[model samples]
Target: MTDRDLTALLERATEDVVERDFAENAWAAALAARRHRRRTLLTGVGAVAVAALAVTAVQLGGADHPKPTPATSSTTSTTGGTLSDGTAYAVMPQEGTEGQLRDFDAGLPSTIDVRARAEAFSAARPPGSVVAVYLRADGDDLLHPVLVAGDGRHVLMGDVDLVRTTDASGNEATPLGPRAVGGGGRYVVFPQRDHVLRLDAQTGDTVSYPVPAQHVEWAGWNAAGTRIVARASEGAWSIDPSTSRAEAVPVVGGYEGTFRVTATDALPSDVRVTRFDEDGRPLMSTPVRGPTWSLWGETVNTETLAATGAFFDQNVTSKVIRRGYGPIYQGLLVVEPSSGAAKVLLAPENPDGQTGRVKGCCTVLGWADADTVLFQSLGSHGRWVLAWKTTTGEVFEVARITTSAPDDPVTPIALNVGRRS
Candidate 1:
């Protein structure tokens, strides 16, 4: 094919991935491009091999195509298995689309975090805004707080970015912090300099409340979603998102309440992770045997499910990767809260059988209760999702989500689980 022809082919593929709402991530797009490049390289590697094998595009149809069907959930006994209290899952495509998984019937109600912008259909601007949830897709270190909703009707709140990043050189940009949605899907408040953006989940309406403009140590809604709390240069204060009111509460010592997640690299040979009760009592302390460890969750929302990231056998992995290997296997540990014991739930990442692609990043979303933890794998054709049981170490199949557009490319995006009232 001509160079121009190859360019067109790549563009077409990229368009397909994007139209499919696979992932809105630049890394994911790069992966799609690299996959295409690898395919091209493989085609030229051997002529005799081509003659020996012939494969077709993914299809199980005669006339057009048959799509993937969501697998029904199978759980182990509740004695320690993933809880199936009819928990529903909400997904966000990398392309900025959001919706609920009707496939296995999460059985429980779900609410998703989103930044709702006030846009006018014909010029009169709509009112209000919403919340943001930072997610680490695939195994990427960067966290994206993309806005997503449960109904699939995503509303862009504004151009304001919602995630913070610190470069390798120690420079930080977009200092957005952690935020949470209220119980029963009610309201949440996001902080911005002098003004706080508050929005209701059910309605797209938003209200801006004023606050101290100085940079705060941290800002987000309180656990109850009743007010916006932050530790400004002066002290920690809680502001009612509705009234733009502030109260001088005791400045939380960085982390508040019982610390659900803890990381200690005190020993180079053995890393440790521990969960604690609200009173600072250690619940479970498990030591991890690896080269590095990174904790992702604070405290358990309902259970002590936590995800830790690390690069195993660093020197060997680096050597292997330098030899033109696809990539080294980054590891994840799904730890138990009570005993502090841990298990490597996901070994080096691999391609999903259905999508034939791997996640650009491997990260844990949250728990499905005390027994199950949902993982966000945006590596394959679409966003690959899996639910892992803490006790049985069994990974349950969820949906591989994407846009329905015929030509859109699909990549994994972020995922969050919620329960209904």
Candidate 2:
């Protein structure tokens, strides 16, 4: 930009200059140089003054200076007739209470039986008190995901319909099917009847953007969850719930595959992986090698697998490859390609000698950002939990599904960067 344009922008940025700015001199010098380059006869005095003012405002935490806070992915809240933020979630008893849920009815359709399924099919997470989803079975084959949560004492439930669907021939239709839910900061985004549903995780309030076509088959918030993008049989479109606009993006890679990603220097390096030809022929063995099951973080260097959350108890057969799978029963690792170095950050709290199942379980869900990775652990026979790990090795148990105790039966719960409709 020209010096004059730059000056204007800087002026807008420093409208609230103050005394606390220690960088006043720096801004002045920078502006003085720009003014000289522009060949302006005006004395540098005015530019210098503005620079000094801007710096002071910066240090004083003016409106131009916004504080940065750690990003919040999701939060669990209860509705005691209303949401935590005093939004009306419950009209009578807020509709979803332990008693009301016990005496539940979605009133979906006589064809859709919320009663029988209420007794036989139910799902929860965080062991007993967090984000949950359920399916109400009926005479129809249709099943939609419902958001369920509790605050230790009461169970809050809400209706979410999955009316958008696709046939085997890629035909779009409005019918009940499995629904996919993606969470963003302070809210949850999902595909609803015929629109993109944005639900406030805390307030239980909702806003929706109409689907761009007859049936939007897939949808998700950009990495930051600040915006929503969806796909229909016609094509992919980006949606802004805040503005209620949907626009078509590029089709070569499909806008449906795109998401706003966090900026990161941590690249998903081929250095740590093996590349094989289409026929399964070994092509390239990289610096850091992973086993049969491994995940690579997303592109743009914003985030990739920093390391695995679990340990594989096995000896390295060779620097190039590890001969067999050891049950990753311990967990996985993020391997350093440079020296084939890896750190086992996740392991079972209580190690089992024999009869023990793998902890630090399942695969990497996907990277939320450069420093974070989501995963699943199904070691608990009756329960499977979702977890997240940061580059610092701090792990958090986010949600889980409760089930009958069996030898690690497949938990319906799953985590993913993206799952196409």
RMSD of each: 16.8, 23.5
Stretches of candidate 2 off by over 4 Å are 1-158, 163-186, 192-195, 200-218, 231-235, 247-251, 254-289, 292-374, 379-401, 405-421
Task: Return the TM-score for candidate 1, rounded to 2 decimals.
Answer: 0.49
Whole-model alpha-carbon lDDT for candidate 1? 0.32
Best by TM-score: 1
Candidate 2 clashes: the total is 13
**Per-residue lDDT of model 2, residues 200-253, tens digit only:** 534555677776465555555443333455555465556655553454342322
- Candidate 1: segments with Cα more than 4 A from true spot: 1-104, 107-151, 158-179, 191-196, 202-244, 248-252, 256-260, 264-292, 296-301, 308-310, 313-329, 350-360, 380-382, 401-416, 419-421
